[model samples]
Target: MAERCPYPFPRPTALGIPERLTGIHDEPLVPVVLPSGDEAVLLTRYQDVRQVLTDDRLSRNLDRPDAARISRHNSMFQDPRINPDPPEHTRVRNLVASAFSAARVQRLEPRIHAETDELLDAMERSGGPVDLNEALAFPLPVRVICSLLGVPDEDVALFRHWTSAFLSVSHFPREEIRAAMTEMSRYIAEHISHRRAHPGDDLVSAMIRAHDDEGRLSEYELQWWCRLLLLVGYETTATQLGGGVAMLLSHPEQLRLLRADPALLPNAIEELLRWKLVGSSVSMLRYATDDIELEDCVIKKGTSIIPAADCANQDPDRFFDPRTFDITRSDNPHLTFSLGPHFCIGASLARAELRIATQALLTRFPNLRLAVPAEELKRQEGALLEGFTEIPVTW
Candidate 1:
């Protein structure tokens, strides 16, 4: 029997696409062991990754008795929205889709700007040498999501704790993961009950109306939807924000270009998204519903396939000078946000937050520089998310 490839596959560095991932483009699919100790096929090439992501035969139904999981801990808390097929997935996604539509996200821009400014104000007051992750990157997204969810100020810390614990896949014990899930579920349930009694303009209250008035959403679906939104809404944005800042700081020329021309902010954010490594090396666990043939291999039914978006984003075939950090690069079709039905719903909002936060930081702290050597900067290890644990900086 062939040796089973270990999960994560060993990256060359803490930053950028892993060299191992990019080096495997010639192969159709590589073997890997998931955090759950399940052996799976890992797709690296841009075409293969896109094919697997778009193929309906490759399902996200992790609730199956024999579903493959990224980790044992994730198995216990798979959100139905993430693991179901249509019409169930369709139903759950549609109920809250409008809430995240471009129009809705645009309406929140003023609020996002205000929040960004407020956080920058706090960071500025802290004098020099502050961790941007704690002051801005982390808190900004959390505050926005909490406000949208109608979560009270006192409970923000609790939600953060739960989310941090929940994403710590291989790092934390299984019991801790379960405990965080329990507390998060309870907290959402309680707040949802409150929203039912006293409706508000917030997203949670709107979801409650969908459940009570329209009957479009069930209680179980509603709770998990809130949990999914809360966890994803902030987590991805927070990590990306920190990574973006670090990326800019690391590349002074790009930072200078961005500061000289703020019009580049939008495209710069796109490049940043394309360049940064936000999540795990692998995409979410997708199980094969039936035998599926690719260029060089057949994925047996029930086999899990993880498409490495990090690799696809930097695939040399798809991206010219893929490794170069060029803010002006166009025709850059990166899969940092995986494609298909599961494409990030919060993409617009995330873009807005990153642009606003980047603009705010550059405009406010004109001399912002890393407080420590880039190599010395710490990162959150063993979590599904990949980002700096703390980005210490001074202006």
Candidate 2:
């Protein structure tokens, strides 16, 4: 017999966690020690995921406990508002939200369109059998974030490699991840220094001004914020673009519908996000600060609980016909950008980029199709955020 696959994620299986958890199970609350020797409870149900997300007993910042220091580098988990309880998290998040307002994102639409077109133009010139992942998906968000944050375009490729290393889960040594993150921080700090001397109309410059006008943000705070924003800005959106293109290509009929009805673009983006079933694990692991009881079990304090974003999004109870990829799926409430206090700040800008990219892609190459079979394509493995390593497309 073949070796048994790992529990929960259903590696080498068709459906992912949603199926594994909902399938036959021996126990209600399973306990597994992670490679780091940290104890955690892997949740699968929508109700369970939501309860953990909303529960006051659960903490997003595991680094709070002296014993739970998982990483030395500062992380979003360090942002008390993102992962902390009550007033601390609230205060910090309020300060962060000022930088990501709806009005501010509205101004980004034109830039998003221009960036999408530029990439598409390059893609057209490169011709078919092009790797969309390299040509478009990978670079689009990097360029968008660079344009938004005022980072020089030349720095993006190196930063992309650094951020990629930061998020890597492969058997690559932990020290390597740390070094990459440190390099990323150093690079961003240098840019911050440059911007302080000569401010521009980018997000980092705006943040530098904010730091100057009032002592609202510390130098360290600004540095970490820039690093945090850039890492997330590229990694998540790149996954979306790669995954979204895979989804569109997989469902050509939906692409046809989208091409015919450009008005359906917004809804289609939601559907695309839902269809991918990405986010195999939460970006940040939430720790139970105290004993917390759900319908089935009581989670002990000091334990980590990772909410299944993909599972919750595909929960049949929450979403009707959870498997289908309908471009016009009317009642799409995906947690892809997540929900509540920890929701993604750049969602509007991300949406604009996706909308423009998708619209322009189908318009420019109406006959776009995969150059190879789906099974033949390689997906980047050993990482929580997954996408095609190279999506070769022919038009």
Candidate 3:
């Protein structure tokens, strides 16, 4: 058996990177056991992480008999766009790339702003001590993504439950995860059929056109793509919104700095993303296609490797005083989003949502502060995504 340390080493009490990771930053790779009880190498150094992420030898094709899996879930059942290597991955990504382009995101800004204002209006009416997570963070991204995908407002809660179950590590039982996946898959298939007859200008309808009119994707591929988008589209940004707000409130000086100069919001968003560590310690699991030698050790073929984005972003070699939260810091090339071809497809949309949401909150509520004591806020545990479960705040 491989030497195993605890997965998701504990983070500090304050806003910053995990101290345990920093202590082992000099090590090329550390061994860890996944929630599924699979052993994998955790790449900590920035350069090592980038290499593993970009290397062709490190494959995401977990369908192979010897493929290392992070969970009991079948990799073959995963979205074809994400699991396959080149040519196939290239085709699927290209087909959907235009939908999430910077131009498309820019066009959606007016609607995003309107949505933000509407949420704020409701929060204001509710008066003091609101759970910002429920009031704004959760709703904004869900509404935006749902509108883009043509999902009905009534079904938002259903998708939320499905997404929660899908993204779980061990927080949810395997049977529960499978049930959620089955329900979500069935819903997407039905939704696609509906879109085919009554097509709209949403992404789902566009995908239908790609499949039926252009033959760019298959029926199964279309369903998986829709399912993947629904989960990623809201989960990441929603959690980030809650985490970002909590981080800002925790550091009043930084919050004041951002408020004094609203232009700093973009930079502040980047800093928050890097500092918040909302993502898991590891990126998606990749298996070594063949034996590979790193700077310090060898990874045998079929061994699993996880590029630790959280660790790389805080690498002192890459950034000065990396642990310190400095929004104005220049040349911030953080790897909160992994590098290479599999880079986050919805990154631009996520950034736009965070920027708009952050700006709206700060501008509208000049005195926004945490309702509960800073230390009292509960951090979500036993999950791949790390964030506060509830963030109560008052203006």
Candidate 4:
């Protein structure tokens, strides 16, 4: 055994990376007791983490009796339909891949910009010291994704409630999580029923066609697509936005540089993605189908592995002065988005949102500053996507 520490070492500060996860470990593969009480070998080095992502033997299906549960109750993690491997994953992923393609996301750029402005206008009219997360970060992604998915924006709050509950492992009780998941599933079913009777150009309507006309998707898979798409399309972007804004506000020097050159918007977004915008981890756990060998130890069959992308992004071997947040970092190949077939489908869309939102912020609120000190800011810990719940700001 290389070493096993309780997983997710505490951050030195709210906007800072944990020291243990920041450095390169000689024995990169070490055992870690997850919040769920199950132990899994954690991969921290950039090369190793990147390698594991492309390995076919590591499967995301953790529903098996032998595999470790990421959390005691991450309801989303236990589903085989959530992230099935290979031909199965590729089949369903292909259905919606085009909708999230760079081209499709490009068309949405105008809407994204408009939505970004609309929210900023709202924030401005509301006056200073307002909760930026609630006013802009949370709603902006919801509005854009809803327009893409064909879901009504009226239920954004409902999605937030259900996703928070569904994603949490130790934050909420088991019964609450189950109830939220049930309600979310019912909500998707209702939408599917509506779309079947009255179809449109939106993603949900297309999915309805895939389910009813093409017969490609099972009834369960259809609803699963609707539910999971909505959850991922909103939660990850929202969390990133909150954390990104916080990181910029905390680093005044980089913030000034970004504001001075509007061209750096895309570069800044990549830096934010490379940075841990959420709690501690990036990608989740995978189960070993057979015994696997790594640079350090032998991962026996049935073992659970968590490739910590957040830590990998900070590996000095890959990133020069990885600790420093550089806006002009051109050689960045961060693993925030995993590699191989399981790479995040919504990555382009997420980047567009961050770019548009950040640009709008830099343009409209040139003097944007946090309402409170950086360390005083709060984070939603132990949630499926941990981030600032309320980022109070003033212009």
Top lDDT prediction, candidate number: 4
With a 3 Å backbone cut-off (N, CA, C), the pairs that clash in candidate 2 are 81-89
Ranking by TM-score: 4, 1, 3, 2
* Candidate 1 per-residue lDDT over residues 1-395, each given as its tens digit: 24667777555544555566656677767787877787787777888788888889988777676766777766534555454666777787887778778998899899899989999998999997999888899888888888878888777877777877777767788888889889888888889989888888888998898888899888788988898788767988999998888888988999898888888888888888887557565546788889988786787898877877776777788888888998988687777777787788788888888988988898899999999877776667667786677888999
lDDT of 3 at 115: 94
Candidate 1 lDDT for residue 19: 61
lDDT of 4 by residue, 201-241 (tens): 89999878888889988888888878888887888888889
Q: Judging by TM-score against the true structure, name the best candidate.
A: 4
Estimated TM-score per prediction? 0.94, 0.87, 0.94, 0.96
lDDT of 3 by residue, 38-127 (tens): 678788788788777778888877766655455554232334345567777779888888878999999999989999999999999999
Weakest lDDT window of 10 consecutive positions for candidate 4: 21-30
Scored by CA lDDT, what does every candidate get?
A: 0.80, 0.69, 0.80, 0.83
Consecutive 10-residue window with the lowest summed lDDT within model 2: 1-10
Candidate 1, after superposition: displacement of residue 263 in Å?
A: 2.0
Model 3 worst lDDT window (10 residues): 73-82
